[model samples]
Target: MFIEYIAQAPKEHQKYLKKMYQLLKEELPEATEKFSYGMPTFYWKKNVVHFADNTKHLGFYPTPTVITAFKENLTKYKFSKGAVQFPYSEPFDETLIREMVRFRKTELEELQ
Candidate 1:
């Protein structure tokens, strides 16, 4: 289902989506991955992140509070509610992605 989700995206966006998936998977080694809400979702205690390839940007869902915590660094990007949009024209910041996932993992661990 994960592979199918990526494969079904636009060819130009496939690389970005694949890269996002790989980054999250590598960062959260113990997390479980699955197709949830029709996108690739990485779950620790709950859904940690969900990413999708959009028309001209990659959508990152790390929850609203997480997005707000990183808002200062994400000023150049577009965001709303629980989603952040990183345009395909701009390089995806893997470091930011890694940080968000690590933060999510920690947050979840503390809750349990």
Candidate 2:
């Protein structure tokens, strides 16, 4: 489903989506993939993150708690309660993304 979703996105957005998919795949090796809220989602103990291609930016959903936890670092980007918008004109902060994903994974682990 994720592959199909990527394939159906605009040509220019494909690379970004693929890169995000690879990064999340590497970060969450044991996570399962599914479509939730019409976006590609990664789930471990629960939904860890989700990403989708939009008109001018890529929407990254890492949950509200994770978003708030990394609020200081997200000052440069546009973010809401549970989502962040990474513009197409800018490069992705892969390091920060990895850290957030790892933090979410740790949160899940501690819950069990």
Candidate 3:
């Protein structure tokens, strides 16, 4: 999925392409990576995250914990049960993603 998306993505999104891939892998070192429907998804005993660059936006596979933790900050963005739609024409919020990665990591650890 990741490789396919990488190949299909527009040249401008290449910068974010690498960054997003790196962050996901770094955040979930033990995650099993695979492609599904041309999307890159990571699984760590369960689904951790999935992402793809759409024609107009970059989408993050939404997790409830992420939505709850960043509700206030993400109010302006479009979201659904498990999807956050971020515009691809601009920069993504790296800080928020980093925080989410940390928060999810801890949450999963606690469950164990």
Candidate 4:
């Protein structure tokens, strides 16, 4: 049931989701892709990042460290306490997404 919904979003959302998946794969080559809680999640050498799309916007679930680090850069966007809510009309920030991936990777590596 969850997998079906992730696979059956609208066309526009599908495009965005594809873009995000590709970008995450490129940025975090070591990460593995998984469908969890109806969202596309990336698991690196350890857990890294996750994201999902809604009818209105995309939800980026970076760790608290990521949110704190990018708090200043995210000022322009509509972010909740932790997640970054990117509307469909606006383009996704690939650079920032890459940065978060890199940051999480580094954190996980250090912990290990």
Pick the lDDT winner.
Answer: 2
Q: Write the per-residue lDDT of candidate 3 for residues 1-112, one digit (tens) a residue.
A: 4666686789877667778888888878898888765578887756777788777878887478777777777776788766788787778898888787777767777777
Candidate 3 Cα deviation (angstroms), residue 29: 1.8
What C-alpha lDDT do the candidate models reach, one value each? Answer: 0.85, 0.94, 0.77, 0.79
Best by TM-score: 2
- Local accuracy of candidate 1 as per-residue lDDT tens digits, 61-99: 999878877888788789887899989887799998888
Off by over 4 Å in 3: none
Candidates sorted on TM-score, descending? 2, 1, 4, 3
TM-score of each prediction? 0.93, 0.97, 0.84, 0.87
Q: How close is candidate 3 to the true structure, as a TM-score?
A: 0.84
Model 4: CA > 4 A from native: 1-6
Error of 4 at 58 (Å): 0.9
Candidate 1's C-alpha runs over 4 A off are: none
List of clashing residue pairs for candidate 2: none
Count of steric clashes across candidates, in order: 0, 0, 2, 0
Return the TM-score for candidate 2, rounded to 2 decimals.
Answer: 0.97
Please give me the total number of clashing residue pairs in predicted model 3.
2
Q: Give the local distance difference test score of model 2.
A: 0.94
| Tens digits of per-residue lDDT for model 2, 43-111 | 998999999999999999999999999999999999999999999888889999999999999999999
RMSD after Cα superposition, model 4 = 2.4
Candidate 4 has a TM-score of 0.87
